[model samples]
Target: MSTDGKSPLPPMDWPDFQPGWVWLTGAGPGDPGLLTLHGLNALRQADVIVYDALVDERLLGWARTGALIEYAGKRGGKPSPKQRDISLRLVELARSGKRVLRLKGGDPFVFGRGGEEALSLVEAGVPFRIIPGVTAGVGGLAYAGIPVTHRDVNQSVTFLTGHDQNGLAPDRIDWDAIGRGSPVIVMYMAMKHLDQIAAKLIASGRNAAEPVAIVCNASLPDQQVLETTLSRAAADVAASGLTPPALVVVGGVVPLRQALDWRDGLADASVLDAIGRRTRDAG
Candidate 1:
């Protein structure tokens, strides 16, 4: 394994993380191994690391000694720092001549509200850099042995959040259009509203028996995957006793988990060969 647990790659001169600049970075799901080199570079250089709840604590180990680590994670129904306050804190820290690193789980741009924070920094005249990380929608699903797309399943996929700014199912989302157009739908933080979302899709013409997979604590050692039908998803998830910080995937691609699950020792050699053949054929 590479020193960081990620795949080995050619070395290059990394960018200088200037003090008094804010770096918004994605920590990549829950696995330290999945973190981008650029994100890792920030960790080693930042004076203060402001991290979210979903970010694995293990990644913080890479930070420089004496680097101040601050918690600013926001969870459903949890009393946490307000978004605006968090943005202001970045501005405050940057102005203090500190190298501020805003480390979040998954891609900072994907449903992470990084853009909002960046805008605040811009208005405050704070220089910043964006380091994209592997989103849970893809990386997390991969860890659960579920592909977002497959030649035999879907050619397109949709990524969406389960709730809006108000912490409820988004009212702006066109369930009808998405249900009818997208063959595969990957949802972040949808476990809380799974029943309603599932109903909306079913009412919008999605099959009631469509395969759905919910992955919790994705990319972590204790990751849990629960598979059920669109109609029974809510019930099954409740029965499984899993909580939030989970991803919900809706599509025909979910059943492929039976063949693609490779984590630990769960991989089946025959299925692996079949997947290889299919991939080669597609290529």
Candidate 2:
């Protein structure tokens, strides 16, 4: 129980909520404004926040003064705290009755490993809540002025991880099925193996000239988007030195991006304007 009179007040003959423990939270993709109310509440109340590398640090400023922050980011082939260790630490902090917040980039359940951590907490009999966030596959695409689902393009969309933590294409994912099945495919963390991935999709009967859009550092000032055909995607990324923490979208929806893009006139503003005028004239 906390020393404060307002906190840790017990219910008559019932168990109390643990104060020192964790909330495994997703901060959303790059945009601080996208944080859920529950997530923001946890951040403000937490005694410590263990966060991923991709999480924008600026969001940490929202935490109450004197809160502790820990970095537990795991990047492919980069030195990082082991997942097991991170999970165990959450348990440890909770046992101590300290409010712990495990902050991750994007939805923690979407390839962010919130499940593993949640299971660990469950095993320890710790109560927890899931605060979902706007995942990169959707939000990142939106930031780049691309819509994952479009009435004219696709009614269905598929979200997939590019590679696993080991830097290999996830063995469990059926690339062939995904290539053949999904009308619109959005991938996260696939830049490193983009060449081989592109080849696989093509071999699975996807068109070589199918449009592919790669948006790196989505929703941030350093963001860049590259438009290419499936066959040229890997080569173009390589040539341009684009790196991961990027989102890739494939299929016809990539074409609409050229028209939907509204910022800095990257898309033809004149064209959309002309189309609007024509619609008005027709009406």
lDDT (C-alpha, whole model) for all candidates: 0.90, 0.82
Residue 155 of model 1: what lDDT? Answer: 91
Over the stretch 1-283, how does candidate 2's per-residue lDDT look in tens digits? 2232224324343222249657888999988988886677677678889999999999998886788898999988779889999999889888888888999999999989999999999998877777788898888888888888867556788888888767787778888998888878898888988888899988988888788899998887788899988899999998988887889888877766667786546677556655344323321
Q: Assess candidate 1 and give its TM-score to the true structure.
A: 0.92
- Candidate 1 wrongly placed segments (more than 4 Å): 1-11, 269-283
lDDT of 1 by residue, 1-283 (tens): 1344534335777777898999999999998999998898888788999999999999998887789999999988989999999999999999999999999999999999999999999999999999999999999999999989888768999999999899899999999999999989999989889999999999999888788899999999999999888899999999999998899998877877878788955766567556555434322
lDDT of 2: 0.82
lDDT of 1 at 182: 95
* lDDT, residue 69, model 2: 93
Model 1's alpha-carbon lDDT is 0.90
Listed in order, each prediction's TM-score against the native is 0.92, 0.87
Give the range of the ten consecutive residues with the poorest summed lDDT in model 1.
Answer: 1-10
User: Model 2 — TM-score against the truth?
Assistant: 0.87
